[model samples]
Target chain A: MAGVAEFTKFPSESLKVGKGFKLAEVDPDTTPGYPGNKADGEALLEELDDKLAELQEKLFAESKFGGTKRVLLILQGMDTAGKGGIVKHVLGAMDPQGVQFKSFKAPTPEERAYDFLWRIEREVPGAGMLGVFDRSHYEDVLIHRVHRWADPKEIERRYKAINEFEARQVAVGTKVIKVMLHISNDEQKERLLARLDNPAKHWKYNTEDLKQRAFWDDYMAAYQAAFDATNTDHAPWYVVPASKKWYARIAVQQLLLEGLGEFDLEWPKAEFDVEAERRLVERS
Target chain B: MAGVAEFTKFPSESLKVGKGFKLAEVDPDTTPGYPGNKADGEALLEELDDKLAELQEKLFAESKFGGTKRVLLILQGMDTAGKGGIVKHVLGAMDPQGVQFKSFKAPTPEERAYDFLWRIEREVPGAGMLGVFDRSHYEDVLIHRVHRWADPKEIERRYKAINEFEARQVAVGTKVIKVMLHISNDEQKERLLARLDNPAKHWKYNTEDLKQRAFWDDYMAAYQAAFDATNTDHAPWYVVPASKKWYARIAVQQLLLEGLGEFDLEWPKAEFDVEAERRLVERS
Candidate 1:
């Protein structure tokens, strides 16, 4: 593992994934808040709400026409990484009916029998649905590789399969957005302590999680490799600096708005037979 | 059609299906909320948020163990009955990753060929997932019956199937919550006018929707029947007065907290290789 100072200084910008997928850093510095900094992000949140509502109306209007565009959002991170919090705060303003969220757990006996992506494929968003995956297929690489559940060769093959899978979704008009919530180890400790200190929040803390935390370096290495192989123009990873919850959430919403903005979602127009409907009302 | 005065005296709580199913009406005045009231409800919202977050932590703790528990919440209503607003503000406090939402639409060619529940069953929450259905299986009884899309006998059969299906879910330990967003026609007109008058909201209005509005009486009858036949101890429907969005949202959060509170979730004892974790951290 790198020194604390060295790790903190790690260039968050210009993440070089692989040969074909060099995602330009969406600078968190440009965002309203940063770690060691505080602002009343709630004011900006209201503005975001207004914009989101407008966008949502457009999306719903498109749905009235049976529009088929779908968006898949994947959030992956370490323990106490704030993936759940980010999702809640970011989508705080949108209508929930338009969105579908899936949180992957350890594979069940049924899931294990099938291929790795089988369960995940089942959860993928249909046309016109917004699917948010909390700790997605990447788990096959993260936990499986770390625990030796799969051999290195198999893990490598799975990584390629993921890239191809995402590319296929994009080709079929599914916009995919992957976000990695990046936080410092010190900040993670603070959050874990916070969870433990509050009785109501105590349920969120698990000492068993520290075992996985011990493999921080290995997980980081695994993340780098997976990002290298899977990040592509079709589905890119937005490494979000998540020390500040508000800023991290807004960053995700911005990415989603940009992705969905590419679609021309117009409401379908049809004439209404008011008299017929009224007669039907009388008969019923 | 009933006159305005007739509507004023209508017993909104009564739900009777076909011939036999008759769900006793609880007093509508004491149900959730009513028209022109929200000042006190705002404070209740903050308290609701605290309560819901606590329940969410417990739900998360349960997920840490091997098996997953999925909760499906269904919200059905007339247009402008506050379905969108209820979903937006109630789930506004819960963790998004733990919840997946799906709003049903008019069946497409692909969907019409199969049984009505096919697409919906596909959207069912996986283990550890919470799913919210906005206008769900009830549509077969409500819209289909009201519009004469199916015979009354078929609709009655569907009600039986729905009852058995929900009972099966309870047998398997799935907690199902169904809420009917109830609003008066007067309130609906005010909301619709508000949308039409606001430029930003004009996009939400569809001329064709007004034709459906003409059949408000028929839809209400359909809804009453649907609720009566489907409401059971395993999956009861809460009739929520949604003239006030704040009151409605808070009510939903409270109901959800109560539902999940039935499960006294505790964290599995912390079992971590403490020495191994410390050694790994020290080595790093």
Candidate 2:
């Protein structure tokens, strides 16, 4: 891990805090190489998709019976990371109505007036719904720390606030799963260049992004600190190796299924009015 | 329109205006149905999908080249009103990488502290990307109005604020398309009952939803007011008859294609170094 190209070098170890709290920090060595692992990634993604679809159906059925719960999955990553692609394939299997995807942005003047978690809570999915966040409140720590937008003491307070907030959500039965997609700067540059040269995607390029790219090391350091501090059992972080978009999506999908699998989704009893059906049939 | 049962009657001729504009009131008996009479709704939808797919490819190619102007389509409607189905079919034709879908929900403490549009601006698709809002900031009018969370004066102010917000987006070259999936209450009830009885949908059932169902009249009144206040030529509301989910999807697909047709998307000229390529190849 130490001698390999820094872009592909990742620490190979799991951070375990007692029994139920374990952080799977993906090792770059174990991570699949793109194109080389495309076949395996696609197959795994498809398989994960099938299971998600099946479980989602059951989850929906349970929702229809007057007892439904919502699922919120959050994705965090640096620019040029594979959050968009991850969402595309992971949700490829479920019915659209069962899902709601939301991508959080920088706080506006109005948002600035409120506490950090305020905007996030408003978008929580209702029962029987699914909400996906591309970047979430954790930005308070990651981006804020990197940009020096908040005091160190305040950032410290926010880490605990985020953990407690997530715990409260989990306590309320919301299956909260967070994923941090990690991609190397080389890959990021490659993808950004692709975006620059592709006409259909020409609209996505911005001059400002290049300036931000210069601070890659700073962002990574901040991310490492944020992930280390905020990752907890209630809303644990899964550091995904996203050099391969397909494999990243597969891993995230499987993680989601594993988390949601706790809910015994089943078809509830339907109270059909037999007499009303018969009367309607007679009238017709 | 006057005599139909609550929330279930199709106001085939309902006139809708958005933000500081007034449309001629729709009288179901007098207003003509589906004036774009070149083809059946379903056929038109297919054509729209084909065209949209073509345009999306061009758009993504531009995106790949470094353009960031993204498109955002907003869909708004009541429960069982086919928002989900429309999303599935209309967007089914686009490349997933170029598009992202979002659904707005009830405000959390964080969201409540900010203005309604704060969350929305973040969700806007970047250039070469497509963003879809299953339900959007218009909720300020629909739910906030009905619940009296905002005074009438504030509601009135929102009409202009929303209009200006969307127009500013259009000015910046974001293709904004809004679709109101309209369905009759009778149709909605049929669908809801079906969901209840269908074992696959039991998980989607919620007792609270039924409680909301009892206030159908209030919701429709709110819908009528919302469309009346916010519909504009820039982002005209396409009221698709959603009695048939397939047809609704197709209608939305067509509208998307039409909106995207304005872009002059093309591939960029690449500056490749032939000598470098040859030398690199020989070295390998």
Candidate 3:
């Protein structure tokens, strides 16, 4: 939040957090984007943020009042991996009116009664808009698998359900982009301790993170398993090394830009003739 | 992740994310910690991270193999508030063997069969361990209120339930720390758009964020209301301005340290005489 930073293209393949992708192989210190100083990178990020905002505005305008297709960004990461920074600096650029951000917390009593995707379905960005899931149905597989919350059979079933669900989204024109923000255990400790040392951040620290930290290996394996099971071309999972906050932030921004660009989104044509509208304005 | 940073004490009063709090009031860019460049801040963060790691180790050691009391830190915030950051940095420093982190995603079919807190109770940090809830039952009142998922009476009822739940935790020797990572609307935009620009980050961008962004005012009001309704002396809510990633990270770490400090946690006394045990081990 201090300032946006510029980012360069990210090596998505190197950072994928799933099968064939070992979390241990990624270095949190590596900056995949602009290899500039923090200040310059941040400044560039601000500039890029503005540019992205314009694109999102157009994307949203097209989707909503403009009659364009919609976009959905699914951010997945362990606790404190900077998914939030991406949201604040990248997605934040879009006009709030046109975007939909859902931070999926624990499901409620009613949500539990239905399939996991049911709630996700209710919140998918409609036509001509972009939708963001801070955490998504993927949790049903990731955390569930790590913790063995469900039997292997059930977990297997949900993975299939997820693939089918996403295929459905793509069919309906929801550009489903999934990114796993990958951070190292060392980096994770640094981030968590910052909060422990600062009183103002007390509310942000969860003792459970320490508890879950216990399962880092399990979670990593789980993520790898989930990615292997669900990383379809229609919804391929890109793993981003997240140890470097700036790199992760800008890399994600760039990723989003590319996704939207593929849509060939345009400012919706004016509702009326430009010449006539201009003449009326001139008269007024 | 690159380099850790040094941090100063944070202002808890100013950062409380609840009632009488204006999101705009706090500048996200403020680094109450070390006011140096990003590099220095990160360095100090790393130094603090190691120390906190040691402390958490002691805390956990006293509980698990050591036998100590329990700690719970609950984090609640709007999307992109950096809860994840605190989790990685501060809590990550702790021994993963003893930490239990539960990110409460949307409820599952089985979870919905009971009250909101049903699942929460099942996940509380056990004796001598640390438990973290990425998002707790607070969502029952938060998102529910913003979208009118529940009536006013129901919202009020849930608030009461949360207070009671925390009170019970206190009775059971659980140190419940609640935090809210607050960011300005402008900061949020920068983040969201960054996601849009980066194809790699498209997954992090949720169109739903924009829809939720549309209801910023409503969510803000709802947050303030919830804070008033549920924030208690025993489990008070601290709002940290997260625009400054370092400041927020350090603040939460400090808060957790203080919480753990109060416990007088010590390496649990050995069950048997150390010298005798050592002699037996030597014999073996």
Taken in order, the candidates have interface RMSDs of 5.6, 7.1, 14.5
Instruction: List candidate 1 segments past 4 Å from native.
Output: A1-36, A40-49, A66-69, A144-156, A185-208, A243-247, A257-284, B1-36, B63-72, B108-130, B174-176, B189-211, B227-234, B244-247, B250-254, B257-284
In model 3, the runs with Cα more than 4 Å from the true position are: A1-19, A64-68, A281-284, B1-284
Instruction: After the best TM-score superposition of candidate 1, give how far the Cα of residue A243 lies from its true spot, in angstroms.
Output: 4.6
Candidate 1 lDDT score at position A155: 94
lDDT of 2 by residue, A166-193 (tens): 8877776688877778777777777766
Task: Order the candidate numbers by TM-score, best to worst.
Answer: 1, 2, 3
Question: What is the lDDT for A282 in model 2?
Answer: 35
Give one digit per residue, the lDDT tens place, for model 3 in A81-156: 9876777567655554456667787789999999899999998987767788899999998888888888999999
Clashing pairs in 1: none
Per-residue lDDT tens digits for candidate 2, residues B52-120, read 766876776666567666688888877777776766667755555466777787878898789888888
Model 3 score (lDDT): 0.72
Cα lDDT of model 1 by residue, A1-284, tens digit:
12111112212233323464422343323343222223435444545666665565566656555766788989888888778776677765666766677779889999999999899888898776777888999999988888888999999899998998888888876888888877666666667666654555555556666667778768877877788878787787767767767666656766677677767655444333434533443443
Work out the TM-score per prediction: 0.74, 0.61, 0.50
